[model samples]
Target chain A: MPVKSLKKYVGVPRDVVANFHGKQVVYVSWDQHLLFAAPLMLCLPPQTTFRELVDGPLAALIAPDPDAAAVDWSTVQWLKANQPWVPDFDRSLADNGIVHKDQLRLSTPGLNSLRPAA
Target chain B: MDMKTEKKTLNLKERYRLLTRDLGWEPSYRSADEVFPYVKYEGIKVHDWGKWEDPFRLTMDAYWKYQAEKERKFYAIVDAHAQNNGHLNITDARYLSALKLFLQAISPGEYAAGKGFARVGREFPGVGTQVACQMQALDEIRHAQTQIHALSNYNKYYDGFHAFADARDRIWYTSVARSFFDDAMSAGPFEFMIAIGFSFEYVLTNLLFVPFMSGAAYNGDMATVTFGFSAQSDEARHMTLGLECIKFMLEQDPDNLPIVQGWIDKWFWRGFRVLGLVSTMMDYMLPKRVMSWREAWEIYGVENGGALFRDLARYGVRPPKGWDDAEKAIDHMSHQIMLGLYQWSFGTSFHSWIPSDDDMEWLAKKYPTTFDKYYRPRWNHIKKLAAAGTPFKNFGLAKLCQCCQLPVVFTEPDDPTLLCNRETVYEGEKYHFCSDGCQQVFENEPEKYVQAWLPMPQLFQMFDGDVAAWMDWVSLRDGHDNGDYDGSRDQQNFQQWRGLATSNQ
Candidate 1:
């Protein structure tokens, strides 16, 4: 059954892109790493280039993992909306079609802390 | 058979009738529909509200007498505990971390349950359900009070216990539980019954109460154990009420089968997520372990809950949609949640630490297949970090599931190596979920969930992205109430006091 209420329950979404005060809220996760505990919620400029995110905030976030730096950036498969999508390093997040609350999953091959190679 | 003499000789059934059903009057000024406006519109067809049964048959006077007796006994123990220095009687200062978590998260939930029950009592057209709800509301408040009084014994000598009242409203982690109650509170009355009564109280209450109470007993916490004993009686009535509500709803009309099924599905998942905290408490928080979280889930969740669902099958109800996933999760969630809590301990009301060598051994033995392979290395890494003087702290806010309000810390059911990252685009805005269960809850009712007052958005947009302002608003004192437990005041002081109690040193 639909929600039974006196008034139509129309609510303004709390995390709309416009609510972020000019910063785009992008969630980045290293797919196999449980060490990070959760996908980091980052506030960055929508106009910020994909390369800048990977090299700047993303670098510092993953720097704690020893094997993270060794994984070649180009080989790191990116998942958006649960499907793989290659990002142009030169393109801005907005230009690359990443929106607010988008969980960009980084499935780094060979950097598996959960199932380490014997 | 004089009337005056007959009144004093009233039986249980007679006393119940006089106090409950006899008290409600037929309103001449307003129709019953107007008086009980919320009884409908959720599409539950109750042919007779009178079908709702109160098996306990307890009268208000009897309830008061019983509760007063329990209260007298409960507080006497609490006062004695304080006078005799019962805080020093605990296993260790680390044990207080579990107590601090209980106060900050679970106690306020009891208070919320009281308010929810009272509202439903008024809305249910039947006097039987109304009386049951009324008694439950009182039970909930009493529980909240006794729990506070029990844990307050620690507040005098503990760091994390100081700011729990304010922390319930404003803290990030407390929202895991706080939002669970808020979700139930915002729903209609019948939904409230299924959410709290059947699912939380009947289905999952053991996973919550038993482990903690036993952990309290094992840890030599007499006050908490007494509080547990006091509340266990009330829990029986609650479980009965929940079962009755489910049976009443289903047996009322065939149309209610699907509706009740949906609610069972929703609440069971919701209750499971909230109990992740308890699972962590059982596994990681208690200094003296009662049982592993996985074992408790097998006993309480899988066995007990499985039997309950089997009985519910006659009503066409299956186990929760999240059951299989939860079975997988029980092995992993405590480790994941503790990892998150430890990393974010700086933001919490309780201190978290790297486990002792004994604790790790216990974890390994308890979770043989998963622990050493998946979790031990991460703990080892943190141990190394602490050794090097930089204890691993995640200084950034974690993205939370919009529905459960928990940090998206859980992994995929099929693949524990990969994060169970699920999302949906509704009305041009994106919403994220940690699992299929939470995602389905949102998809079923996007209108209700979009209004979620998520903490990250509140922190960034409302608090101007200042962690200090956020902490100030939540009343968490930096470096005192939170962070690593090894060298903290709670650790040092407990060792000092307990030593003094033991010897001249």
Candidate 2:
């Protein structure tokens, strides 16, 4: 359903749509630590959520490595990265809100909070 | 009674409405979509053309009057600077390389923006959008002319300023700017606005303009400083347009958000990649630096960009995909790009110099995280080679990124020593990227980027593997225009000119 929204909204060709839907790629950024991670060759289904992306692909790639010392997985909060501005993350990649190649960053919940204090 | 005395003057808002909004006419025969076909393909759903706002309220009469006054003052300064031999007043002749880079790489981009805005001005359906774009179109052309006029005095004495249009099209380094504008021009009007207006002007213009203008003032190049200020006034309006365009598209339809967001992700990376040259120029090229590229990025990009994104939170937009990577790049991009340019100066139009011990010390202080550990050793090695009269340079052709078209010189994120090269096999051909950011860009539109015009591969093929033949093909005067600035004609001429001025005094 969200794939249809993506196709209708962006007007991407069916083949490109199929490629986006079939592939599992999410661009991840942690702004606080200046860490970015994206899978070059890996493919995940279109319906992958921010939680799944971080818990699955990101944690596997970053948590076990000594080089990812800056990325503390326990404190990570996901924010949907867009252009001109960024907004709070509240949806899956396949949701009508998220498009292919859309960027998401892992931050501490309060570090760079987009939500306003009441 | 005279006709001027008989006429009554209209207020600013009334005149603007009369000039822009009241001038629009619906197509009699052709449908709206038929008349404006380009906006549809980009999938930006603009329900009402009237929603597009002209923030400057700049009607043509006011536009011309304002521009003319600015031009008159700008040219007067240019004339004064030329008559006074302003080139000799600079901190060093080496400072002119930044101007040379600006002329060859950046001024041509302004021309490209002029052409792009002209096309989009006609193509967008809204009269307000059209008028705004047309004004910007003229502004961009004025920027190009002013920059060239400001720098032409130096051209009389320098080597690289000539044949910039040709060199920009053919040179490997200048291709970064060329391809960026070409990309924006080729896109639909909405995408073009998002690419240039939003990402470049709104988000990144300060990073490019502020430092260069201040650097010019600091180095006693008043002509360049004047031109920079002149263009910067116009840039404010352009930045407003960028912000308004993004908000207009997002507010129009829920569906439009994704399409606009996708563009933001793409163009932010593209613009950041192009700023590699600017980063190097700010940090390394200027004899008296205005600010370190790291400090500028933190102020203009990280701090300001973070604030901007927070404002857009309700619209569900976030920072660009490469936000973190771009921030990290402030530490290392200048050193990497400078090293690449220094090693390949013989093939370029501008001169290159090894960093003085003081310069290296400045770099280490600015880039505390990575400079001393990773990059300092390399510069020290190059210094050692220079002392031994070898002065290392890579004569071989480097494999360039398929997306950015830059040499694959970026380092791995974790290990700063290894080159951060990523390759993807698409349609049976291997595509290379300088980093994950660039690789992600290519993966987004493989069909579009597969057709990139990489100059190095083309030159290598054209010259049949001879770099000297390639140099001849590109018309770079090897000994005179290219190589070390220490003993170059430009340097010697500056020294002699200063000596003459001193003796005369």
Candidate 3:
């Protein structure tokens, strides 16, 4: 649920991927026109470098969970075909899993207007 | 020590020499003019082809690695920001409106330039232009891609970005850019290089890029600023190529003088018309802070282009034809266009607000002619509405310029009265333009403008249900200003990143 909420906050209206079930993808929309979409597959244990993410055929993992190989790989294939993008499809998968190093603390004082009472 | 090494070095140059000059046999089938007819029609005589020198000396390997690295660095920024939720504390959601205009109006042009430059590379076989065209082509592609990539984050929250790529091809104001570049492409190679490369890139790129980037930085738009500056670094090199090409043509032959001058005149004005959008962006779009359009133009256009033109005059070259129109234009184009955007941008992009009292005062002083006399009246009227707590009306259509394809209603050169009344008739249908240069563009090709499907029409189409339902769209198509940037999701993300950075320290 937190991951799903994070997607909405990053500017991806959930309706876009209502059926995008393969993995959690975090998208950052800038300038109201450009969209950068990256999947969140394996979360890092936290405090990882750029290299640890590519441990194996990371592309294959997103390809078809093998259990779901009957599903279309065309979308994943197209993404891999255009890899090394400015969104860094490779590193994004690792970074998404970062375990929070800090405890969460927040209040609704600033956001009460945007949300109702919990 | 090297008897073998000396022999090998000599052998390499000989082989290259053989391939470049000695290997070519005089054409057995066709005469030179028959083969190179297009270059001659432009009236530029090239006494020496070898005089063309590419300063960057880019080979394939170095170019790809550097370009790829640039993309890597840019993507890393995107990733880091995404993990942390940067830009959650924006002053207001209204700021994204500027970005909406940037995406809808500018990104498609980048792609169009890429396509146009690719064709130029194919058509023009000369190495100098080919290399320049290739770099420009690549630069435009990166611009388009980076723009889309950066803005994608906004799509999760906004409404204006949807159908922007489609709108660029069909929209009315967009025709201003499409027609301008198409004119360059259809013209001779030298004219294409000068009009687009020199006139647009060198003359006004700083004016366009600087404010947009500065506003990005000021507003906490780090990703947008990163992408803009990265493209700008490449633009510096492109500007060098543009300047070099112009100097080369001027020095090549005395007879080449008039043709080059005419192109300079025509393109400078053509390019100037497209900048009307930028003028409005500078003066009105930036929320947190920015230099006004009048100030930027004075420093960049007047000071820079003014100096460059003066230097060119030593070679007997005059300022581009219709320069006076731009001189007149800089006075009031921003004020007028911002007024138009004020009425139209609601519910679609970021909202437009009246200029602050200080900003208006600055405009009055900077644009001594039009501000106090012409625009101040309109601003005062809008201020009255603001005071009444009444919202501005939705949708307005400014009188379109016949030549530049921009809206009319610009103030007179020094008068600010006549409302910049200029018109042209082709096939008996009268067309209006903000300035003479726009009129020339339309007269040059009326068929193009007649077909423009400007924004006013497109908005009507959207309202008429031709487009996807608004506020019911999916991710990446959500558009700008979902109203979350101010301190919700973005705030949470920022605090998290800061905490992580601090804790890691």
Candidate 4:
């Protein structure tokens, strides 16, 4: 039998998010529409890439099935068919002193580093 | 008399009980140092290891059986969930960013500790720490594996999960965790307990694990939270071990009082600095956030830790050396760090704008000190952008502490605006970090954290050359974030599971 589309307000309860056992997920809102996916939790604009969104924390949470057959990329022709928008780094990070990877960042020395001058 | 001595044998259980309780012998040595040399140099003295009590009365068989049972229960849950395509909400797999960070930055550190303890156990054979170390070694391995297994279930559904374990071997920021653990493992057994167990687990873990699991639960993820809490129970045991070890050291000798107090002082501050990330996450990460870092600090740090220390003071143990500094920083650090992360979080982890008016109202009530005074103006801008139908763009590079990896948001000792900034020049180049604790770390052994190969550099390196090859490599390694739970094997299984469930209903 074919899987039906999740019904509006009536299908699955929103709190079912807590019931999930294996994967980490977040609800991202695009205007009024809500999209559910695993890994990234941000409410991204329509253009973020699959690559940029998958971070280290999210990557470590995914468990693989022991008996699943090997994956074939040829089946994923749909991703190539649809061009998704990639996310750009936001500007506010700098105000907090966070440097982009391309930029040179400075850290303050620790207190332990300060000795009664040698 | 001969007839009475004739045939009596104790059973295995009785023998273990008697042996563990009775095996200890009083030292017949030139000095206590000849028997336990390592305990003295670190400035910690233990008058009695015998005074330490294991609350569970966990003899060896009970330990093995209970531990095995726990593993069995956890794996059973893992299997059932996996069989059902238990990954929930399409967004569920995307949140792997947190797991990625844990595996790469924190998981290997746990394993490293196991190795470290194995060595420490050998060095300090008589101290009860060897047993504690053994338990921790096993617990750390369990933590690493359980974390990997829980997350591995999502590998089929997500990207980036695979690269993280490898990333631990390479990342610079990761060195913060690695170096912190190495420092503990290399220190005397007493300091190791203070640093990793007492300071890290007891005082700081609630800040890290509670918020993290709550975030997982709030985000509609169950498996991650389960694993996190499961590992955390073991953390609680470790905490007990730590407290016991410290008290034992302090009571062991008259001279150990000052020494043990100093170790407590040093390790507490060291572990506290590392919790900056946790502070940010607790305060900012979850959509449905829990107790603010301010409240958490007040309750756990001030109330619990402060009170605990007060009780210990009755025994001549003083509060940790830098307790005041920690208290002063707690009021502001999490907010400053979160404000920074909110700006740069785009394309990393799950990015979201700063708090809404409702959220700010909650924060103001929770953190009356700095929220209104310093943080409100900043949130107003973010709020304005959200209202204007513009999600705030990424913020700039927040200065990370070279040692602790926290952003340089610490206020100058007593002042907030004048950033509590410090730096050191090792071998002619300047290295900056946030606090005296971290600075001491870098200065003590500049060679360690300096050797770290940051992940951002590696990612950029991959991106700069061989575009197709890099994309392909990173996609397999990082897990592509393509929208739509459309075509992965996990998604397909999810569909099948959904189909079956609904049909049954």
Candidate 5:
């Protein structure tokens, strides 16, 4: 039924914009790490930090389901590809020097079972 | 009695004028509006029909003679190639997938162009312009015929080359091309010129033809290369016609400038979206890569197209909108599209394979910034999964963009990782686009595009939501032709054919 439900939403996650040459692009994985969604295109104005994005656009875009409990902000780990999870919400995406279109998997404190053991 | 004999002979220019412009007949009872009603609706202003230029001075007599000679020479090569088993000379059997794609996706587009140009040729008010359109109509038809003839030999040895016109109408991926031409055909004559003639022929033809022909040359498919060369000469005149049409429109009235610019913006993005297929072929499908898609885009799109816009700046024309987004997309479009095609090969007419390590290294060298860091890892993972006996293929249908009909695979402009899902509600129904450009195209002419023949919805309605039934309805034989290349019928056949040849040798 879920797969059929996906068919109703006529699009797949195939378009990956890979042109981040000579710029700092941060990759943050979202949605329980089950789906390989495209990264957020950061065209925010200057002086806008990653913290602002998480609080404002990202939170609004990926708010927890009403049926599910709210996700704790501080307990979420920002893990890079093949790297251990790091809990640092204060650092900006620009400060992380993330390459454009790179994969950044999100890990919550108790949601380790949702992700493959890494 | 000796009579003074005198005869008058017209020069080339004078003969061209007499043959083209002087041949128009005025209606005795009917008004011009009644005769040429379709030209006035698109809001394109043309004050002087005399201003339309016939730069090639092409007449029907000369056209027939020249084209007949080229056809003669072209078919000779096709015959030779077929007799010599030229299919075996290709770099690898896998390379024919590119040719198969060209046949199914692009060759039918030529036939559509023929029909569109014929309509425009009859409807336009200017005689000279009509003659030019008529010639191009003939050229487009010839292009379709020659391509089909050139590739018909491969049908005996391959699976995808058969039932191309059927596939173009029914296949999900083929809709990317069909919908584009359908859009152009349904517009007014002037907009048709801008959409197909200018945006497609002049702006993006090089990126489409050059790499494919060169790829053909590198792979020893002489017949295909010959077809490309023959079609290209006609393309030169078509390019001139495209340029002439735009300039004539802009020079006629200042009122036409904004309209022309809007069409350019709309059609350029549309044309670029169609070229997504060609981009994948140039980068991934060719066994011996002729040039990188990025390199081809820079030369054909950025340098030449940028210069053309700069030259036109004197007439208040700038480059098309979304130029920046297109430039950025060049780095990742081919890589992204190949992954999609490889994963979905089971549903397609052709086979797909993972790039070898050597191919990946070459891609890394070509795309120094992104390939090594971003794409290579994903590919490595896919290859590992495939080795572990779990290859990726989408079992469910994909949602296609309402405008381009391509699978919504494009990411956001500024960020490469995020999917750019843009939608607008029209007539209480929401329409989705892959990017802002496509969304803008839809919003501009919602009435025209809202009627787009999207394959997925049609499949659901017509085939009871079964992909296998849909494939059967479309004439694509499953397992026999479509799937991974390693153990498919085509690959196995090629191995057998080559083995026999080796034994005889």
Candidate 6:
């Protein structure tokens, strides 16, 4: 469906990768973790390795969750834009096919984020 | 015999007709299409201009007299409320968060409505519609001013009320409202009326207004309550105009049904997204609760809105497409939104806190089905985190829905635990929505949403991606303006002042 307008109507999206000063906006959703409101948006360089994201910014972002320290990355599953993608920890984000504005759903299979014996 | 001819003054109804209905002349030099360029663009065909009616038959002279009387009474109460140190009279300083949110996020929308109505009034070909829109323009501006006037007292004695106008454009949370108005104001005249006048005023105003007014009355905010009372008549007039326009459009032609239905579907969901903020405020912000957001929705949204759609059914109009989803959401929306707010309190102008034990108990009783099962445990996690001296905060920003401009905090309707995330690739740029309803709205009009200056994305792009710079850009004074309600300056001052107001020590 198109916009009902008097003139030509399609517009350039404001959040395209070109506008973000060499960084791509990636959304991280921790499965079953309702505490962090919504997915956290992180602006990262395209070359940042998958391992660096987990140990650095991703680690800091999910630091408040009690389950963060217990996650087994080897067994954890990842979905990028609704499709399953295995994490090559040594590979860059661009190599993993995670582009700008893509949402990566990190589902820890056995690690449900229920009230963790607090 | 030629007797002296005496003239009697025109009656109110006659004067109203003379002033409003009789005040149009067709353009001779320019074509109608040239004169009103936006009228035919949306494809709503109007056969007659005479069908539009103002139920009150209000003329400029009578309108002035009525509004002037209201102003006199309202200002008097405002002055008294200020002079009497009424700031200390609220149920708690915590209640001020609702006021701050109202002023910052919602009052500016009133001003936007005023501007939208004025622009559409000029574009509309019908003289009656022009008159109605003109009158509503004045009403909306008045509502904005009076709301600011009522809440300005709190500015002198509060933390978060200082930069409401600035906050409307710059803050992250308020973009939901600001962008909503921007979307309406930028659209064609017919869509503007459907979006603001009918969908907003007729269908959703009660959910927004009733809670604030009744909350004010219940919480002892005399100034806010007085403003609410003063705006009551104008609100009624606005509602009448909304209903009249919707009915007129439906009656104009059979071709308009789909167009009108599409708008109703779009704006109802849009309005529902904005109301999610109000739902949180009603449930969590009020110190002395009037009713839970769930109760208010059942009454105002489901009950009153049901009767309205039933009447509209005669015109072959059904309820909004998002109506059933909204019903299922009432149980969980407030809790989800409040939890988000509590965690993200670090970024907001208003204070947020974990609900007290009593407050949680109230919530548990109100939402017995979902609260304990899904939300209560989350709050308990946050509570323990705060008690351990590291209060939880989502330090990063959130991705916003392109259409509604709200963060995608809402969850799947059936599963309370999973976030309801919807996205589509429009012109190679991916856009996200919080629900199917919002997604459908975006898919219909990709052009308008693509240009939306989303605050979060731009914060990184424009504000050097620095937290302090973003805070400075948004006019938040770090520690003072943002954070938890407990131990904040607002709390300390209220407790100390209330002590001084009552005690001899």
Runs with alpha carbons beyond 4 Å of true place in candidate 4: A1-118, B1-15, B18-57, B89-100, B214-219, B346-358, B379-399, B425-429, B440-505
Residue B337 error, candidate 2, Å: 0.6
Q: On a 0 to 100 scale, what is the lDDT of residue B300 in model 1?
A: 91
Q: Highest TM-score among the candidates is held by which one?
A: 6
Q: Cα deviation in Å at residue B211, candidate 1?
A: 0.8
Candidate 4 lDDT by residue in tens digits, A1-118? 1111122112122111122232212211111000001111222222333333333222222111111122221221211101222222332222222222111211122211111122
lDDT by residue (B250-290, candidate 3, tens digit) is 88898878877867877788777788888877766666767
User: lDDT by residue for model 2 over B1-505, one digit each (tens)?
Assistant: 6455655889788899888756589788989778877787767788888888888898788888999999999999999999998878999989988988899999999999999999999999898899899999999999999998999998898788886777888888888888899888877888899999999999989989999999999999999999987888899999999999999999999999888888889899999989999999999999999889999988999888889999987899988988887876778888888887887788889998988889989998988877776666667766776787877665544557778888767767665544564766666455667889889877876766767787765653355446788777677888988998988999999889899988864
Q: Could you tell me which 10 consecutive residues in candidate 1 chain A have the lowest summed lDDT?
A: A109-118
Each candidate's DockQ: 0.64, 0.02, 0.01, 0.01, 0.03, 0.69
Cα-based lDDT at residue B413, candidate 5 = 77
Q: Where does candidate 4 chain B have its weakest 10-residue lDDT segment?
A: B477-486
Ranked candidates (TM-score, high to low): 6, 1, 5, 2, 3, 4
> Where does the lowest 10-residue lDDT sum fall in candidate 5 chain B?
B391-400
Ranking by lDDT: 1, 6, 5, 2, 3, 4
TM-score quality measure for candidate 6: 0.98
Q: How accurate is candidate 4 locally (lDDT)?
A: 0.55
Better of 2 and 4 by DockQ: 2
Q: Which lDDT value does model 4 have at B451?
A: 43
Best-to-worst order by DockQ is 6, 1, 5, 2, 4, 3
- Candidate 5 has a TM-score of 0.82
Best by lDDT: 1
Tens-digit per-residue lDDT, A1-118, candidate 3:
1111112222121111122232222211111000001122232233334234333323233222212233332222211211223223345444633221111111112211111122
Model 5 - which docking category?
incorrect
Q: What are the TM-scores, per candidate, against the unseen true structure?
A: 0.97, 0.80, 0.67, 0.65, 0.82, 0.98
